[model samples]
Target: MAHLLSVNAGRGRPADYTDAALTGIDKRPVAGPVAVAAPGGPTGTAGSGVAGDVIGDLRDHGGDDQAVYAYAREDLDLWQAELGRELSNGVFGENLTTSGLDVNGALIGERWRIGADLVLEVTSARIPCRTFAGWLAERGWVRRFTQVARPGAYLRVIEPGRIEAGDRVEVVLRPEHDVTVEVLFRALTTQAELLPRTLAAGEALNVLSAERIRRRLERMNGVPS
Candidate 1:
């Protein structure tokens, strides 16, 4: 059955990843259960856990529509193979590392019942940024990541509750739409022509997705993004 492999959180601190910058991207696994709840603020808010998971950059990283980030263990293994390195859960700054779930193929607005009470809706695909690139210490990582386009999902808390490592991940709902995480990523980064199709994702497309679509439209209209 689909389940959480681990739950990770990190404290904010200075890092060499970005010229001695303070970043909370280096997350480590937390043992046992952690509370999962709505941030109760903006759409891109973080901090829904009891262990105080840090969001270093509030302007770009977290909010209501991105309360939690999740990545698949399968995908991490694929990266490990390509990079010839050990990649662990939360390495990509994901709060939950999952197994047996098609995270990239998950439809936008897909609802997942995690553990006993937490309900989360798939909001959008994570867009690789400079911080992620720095953390990976990878050259052209953003471009390469965009090309691969299996960006893990960001989820919005629907029903607040607690969750633990090894909790069953149950797909409780899936909206009738073809805008999966991979599809959204491609539309934002490579296939601009596919932008309009993503609107069908409805509430699943958060502020970040909307901005991407807006920029695509502006480019098509010969206007600056």
Candidate 2:
């Protein structure tokens, strides 16, 4: 069954890999229930939606649009095999480590009911960063991850509540759009030409994604962005 395999939260720690001088990318699984709520305001001001979870880079990470990050265990296993390393739940800095779910295949604006009350809407795909590459200490990690185009889904909290490991996840709704998380990731990274089609997802796309698509379309139309 599709369920949360683990709930991970991180604390700020010094890291030379990031310009912020600190990072919360080393998320570790925790026992018991964790609070989930929307961190209102801009990304720079708002923090992670999961209580006890830290967002070290407020300038580029966290916010309502990325309140929660979910990665499937299946994908992690794939990476584990390729990298020849053990990747535990939350190793990718994901808040929720999911099992038996195709997180990358989820459509933009898809709604998932996790546990009993917490509802999260898929917003966008995670764009790998310098911190992520550094965290893994893998050469050409960013490029490799982008090429795979299996970036996990970022979500917006719709209903605030407590959640814990082993909670079942149910798909409540899916928007009528072809813009899946993987497609969105590819459009934003490797395939800029696909950006125009991503607009079909409408406002469901995160602010950063929508703006990027808009700029790309404008540039294509010979308009100065």
lDDT of each: 0.86, 0.93
Q: What is the lDDT of residue 60 in candidate 1?
A: 65
**What tens digits encode model 2's per-residue C-alpha lDDT throughout 53-80?**
9989998789999899999999999999
Candidate 2 Cα outliers beyond 4 Å, as residue runs:
none
lDDT of 1 by residue, 1-225 (tens): 999999889888976555434677888899877988777776435543335788777766778888899999999999889989999999999999999999999999999999999999998999998889988987799998889887999888899888889899999998988999899888988998888899899766888788778887888989964
Q: Provide the global lDDT of candidate 1 against the true structure.
A: 0.86
Off by over 4 Å in 1: 16-21, 43-51, 223-225
Q: Which ten residues in a row have the lowest lDDT in candidate 2?
A: 208-217
